[model samples]
Target: MTDWITTPVEPRLLRGALDVERTAHGILPHRLPAWARKQFPDPYLAMVEAQPSGVRLALRTRATAIELDVLPTKTVYQGAPVPPDGVYDLVVDGKLTGRASVPGGNTHTIDMATWSAVTRPGPMGTARFAALPAGEKDVEIWLPQTEITELIALRTDAPVATAPRHGRRVWLHHGSSISHGSTAESPTATWPALAAARGGVELINLGFGGNALLDPFTARAMRDTPADLISLKVGINLANADLMRLRGFSPAVHGFLDTLREGHPTTPLLVVSPVLCPIQEDTPGPVAPDFDAPKLRFRALSDPSDRTSGRLTLTLIRDELSRIITQRSADDPNLHYLDGRSLYGEPDFAELPLPDQLHPDPAGHRRIGERFADWAFGDDGPFAVSGG
Candidate 1:
């Protein structure tokens, strides 16, 4: 065996994460800040955000071979086929050059039928990349977007150092699991990552799965985070969680915007409603899983008649979001709104059906990412860069 140089993972070598917690076993990257994490202390958020969605290790090295020791906590839904192995995307000099994944780690199994769960421990595994070009180069190994990865060690044939920042515009985004890359094939394949790549911007994704409820702490986190462009994908989580009514959603959105404006007074801000979800389009929610079906599926349980009583629904949420942005944009020219339907509407659905009646599949993720890039970064788009 060739001698290898092992190095401790450092904060300066990480990108797309807000913070990194050095744990007893390894380094855990977090999408949310400590204060925000402390504020929302739900186990679900803690677990999901700690999965390091949209996070990556960036470095400059001449190493022809490298290895990363990681402990990945993978989730398994009871009765559902095992999820595909978590994938690590390797990008070199801004180009996707490779991919890798370790064999095993921790497992959390949940039974959607009974709402019960169990956790089982597993051993750390290593991901190895060899035969890389021989020369100093920028390299980024994007952590698995859907797995809670505890980075244990990094080893290479040569020394490694933090990659120099490219001075790209930073794009900060917040949303639900869709933005968190629910069904994406790999970390960089997540919609936000894909859009950031196409838009030529640095990304900091705050897409907490099932937790993007427009909480004040989330808004505060966004307000404090520096960014050249920002976007918020709202409504679906609120409705699915049955967290609020229309009466509260409007003000909540306004407050969220108000807080963000406090820190990003003139930064281009975009508000995008939920994409096409037929199950919740006209119907209200508190979506429930359909266990009877052979494959896992979801159905909204709230009554459509609840609309008259001020309950939230996709249609209502979209209308309210459009109105709020139109009213606020009159004085805040940097504020803009894009109907989520424009990104994935009925027509798109007819073309690419949502497998679970909720989250989009990988192809759907690509479609959303492409459309988002064209809409937000295209010429005449609000966030369009000069000559981009």
Candidate 2:
């Protein structure tokens, strides 16, 4: 580490976070603004937001080696194996060039039965990338999506400067864990990240695991952010949590769109429904976690004939989303819809089944990313470049 230039990430060199807080460790990034965070004191939202899904350090340097020291907090469920260390992806000159992970960090242990969690402090660790291609080039170190990281220090063999303005269009996407890189191999491999790369746009992912319940604060955050393309991947968390019924779902969606329009009046706003999850497609959930299975599995605890009789079927929800998008598109032409299954439908599932029966596995993430890039960023797609 000799002769390495060490300093915290400059705000201008950071992308995708709404705010940065200088702390004892270093810089802590927030995807949501302080005002929006105050509206929800729920621990679920707190933890979800703290994990930097789309946040990254973007800079230009001739440095052939880079190292970032961070304190990552990994969540470990009681009785389950300790979660793997979070991955840091290095992209050099727009291509994924290397990957590294910290060896040790804090652990947030969760008791599934009691739904309680306790965090044990651990040591700071380093993610080092060496022998980057020679020349002054753009480099991005994508933070781990599933870990809550407190950046401690940045050390590069040569001085780095903020990357100049990349004229690529910005895409702001909000969704559930799928969009958050759940089960993905690395940050850059996540569907949204992959699609953004293929689409040649900058990404600001607002996907929070199990927390994309159409919250007004989230909508407000999306509304306030500047973006050329915007998308809402709704319906998954709403049904997974059994949070609301069709009675409340439609209006909440409308209100959410209304808020987004307040800021991005005509931004290409794409609304996506839930992808194909056999367990949840026909059944509603407050899905119970089943540990005895070979792999972590889930069971839909409640039947459709239950209180949520006709309202929450994934199919029904998709239909409702389609109807809403169709009805709204009459006046708002930029409003578009994408069937979630188009991204991960049955045929594709037969090939790459979801490892957990809920979240897609790493391969599935790549498939979804490829399809999305073709469907959403390709010709005639919602976010397609005019001359591309």
Worst 10 residues of 1 by lDDT: 379-388
Candidate 2 per-residue lDDT, tens place, 246-355, comes to 89988999999999999999889999998999988878766767877765777787876765445577887899999999999999988999999999999988998888
In candidate 2, which residue pairs get closer than 3 Å at backbone N, Cα or C atoms, i.e. clash? none
Give the distance in Å from residue 86's predicted Cα in candidate 1 to where it truly belongs: 0.4
- Given candidate 2, what's the lDDT at residue 321? 93
Model 1, 121-163: lDDT tens digits are 9999998888888899999999998899998899999999998
Candidate 2, overall lDDT?
Answer: 0.88
Q: Which stretches of candidate 2 lie over 4 Å from their true place?
A: 307-310
TM accuracy, model 2? 0.97
